[model samples]
Target chain A: MPAEPPVLEPQFATAEQQRSASVLGMWVFLATEVLLFGGIITAFLATRVFYPHEFERAAGRLNVLIGGINTVVLLASGLGMALAVHAAQKGQRWATLTWLGLTALLGLGFLGLKGYEYFADWRDGLVPRTDGFDPGDVTPGRLTLFMLFYFVLTGLHAVHLSVGLGLVSWLAVRVMRGELPRAGATVAEVVGLYWHFVDVVWIILLPVLYLSGHHEAADLHF
Target chain B: MTERTVSPVATVLTFAALVVLSLTTVGLSFLRMGPAGHLAVGLSIGALKAGLVALVFMHLVRSPGRTWLAAGLGLAWLSILVVLTLSDYLTRHVLPS
Candidate 1:
């Protein structure tokens, strides 16, 4: 009789099963991440509903140019991360590291742009304290609250981006040493999950912050 | 032997979808819809774009159905949290006046 492989030996299984397990596990982890981002979104929604005019007025003053450029920058960084994964899968280690480094640079550019935006916000009296802002036609309490949410949510996102950059940097080192794990796509797969989630947050932010001003300030919302 | 191919075509398609969704949402903003319309359009386009990213680039659709199950359940739980918590917050200041 021919020898049979043991049941516990995953090496004997087809690639399809391995890929499926990785996907499922990654999804479960993503679910948890969704909740994290979801909380911030919920808070944003709640506050925005109660203070529509205040949010509209405050959001109108924001520089769409910065927001728009950051959006493109983030999207490109995400693309680079995706390509790095593809290169790693194809066993092009140098190509993978190069893409990773590009992604890191993009990420840094994003943070740098975001930093300038924040500084502008601070200088323009957009801070949350009742005394932090100038005399505009907004409810002082509500306007301050909107700025608070802006800082907390976007600031938290920046923190996550910083961590993501660090993760990619480490992955870049792995690629350099030719030690990119044979576990194949899981690392790229997981980081991609995080990257997409971050992008998703910005997707919501774009409308609420940048586009909210397009309509009348009194427009009722929830 | 197993093979791993870099799917430039699929990635390009996803990028196209992202761009389209972004444009669609922005165009919708110009329409004078009340708050409901704004919310509906923004969220709808956002959902579609996020779905594209998840499915094509993240390979959610290419993976096993179990992955969807895991993700869907989490989203469901999250919605419940949002609903219940918002219900409490909304009603807290109401009915007492």
Candidate 2:
């Protein structure tokens, strides 16, 4: 007697139907995520319109070098994730594991760099609402507002990145255990899409966070 | 597992372009553009890089209509919110005339 083939659910008559539905579901979820981040950004932009100079000055005080490096790191992680998706589709288990592992490592590298920058900012008195927060030629209140936006935006992004790291790590383990490929490529594809969307958010955040006030670094440390 | 679809070489190239664009945005920021102009340039570059990543790395370019519709609807909703909110805020007088 031959082993039984994997059973498809009644709702999804074909494997392709199941895969399309899964992908569509993930996209819908990501769309919601866009609005979640979008609301914060909209608030920031409104604040910017009112306090352009203060915002720019406060922006300059951030560590652009570290931020820039983190951008590269995240982009690298995206590349690894894209490759992992390709490998998963090809049914190369070991290759999928390798790429996913690399993606997670890069994600960790991003978080590490981001953590270091945050610590440096805190020590430098850059945190809004904290004492000794001084940005030259800009009112403390305005500067504080800018810092508030900065922290909130980047903090939210960090949270998302941490989640991506966990997801990628989980995917790697599953691939190692020979679980995912058997389940079909939908899981890998949707996971890849989520990872890339995170990367896109950072790509937008990089400029809004780092570049907006970078030109006028009146008192930058680095 | 299934057959490979996206080309690895193309993905790598897209990554390279994104990195280069990032560096360029940083470098451009060092020059004096007014606040609005600076933001415009930086964001435009960022958007371009994002387009590459989305279309290539995310496989949106080859995705089915269902996926595209989902993604488009999200972006459209976001745009509506941003534009309308900004319009109202930008037009209001924050100070006494």
In order, candidate lDDTs are 0.72, 0.83
lDDT of 1 by residue, B42-95 (tens): 777777777777777676766556767887897898898788877876786687
**Candidate 2 segments exceeding 4 Å error:** A1-7, A216-222, B1-4, B93-97
Candidate 1 chain B has its poorest 10 consecutive residues by lDDT at: B1-10
Q: Write the per-residue lDDT of candidate 2 for residues B1-97, one digit (tens) a residue.
A: 3433679999999999999999999888889877777788888999899889888998888887777899899989999999999988888886545
lDDT of 1 by residue, A15-101 (tens): 556655665676787788788878887887777767777776666566666776777788777778888888776667778878788
Best by TM-score: 2
Instruction: Give the Å error, residue A96, model 1.
Output: 1.4
Q: Measured by TM-score, how close is model 1 to the native structure?
A: 0.83
Cα lDDT of candidate 2 equals 0.83
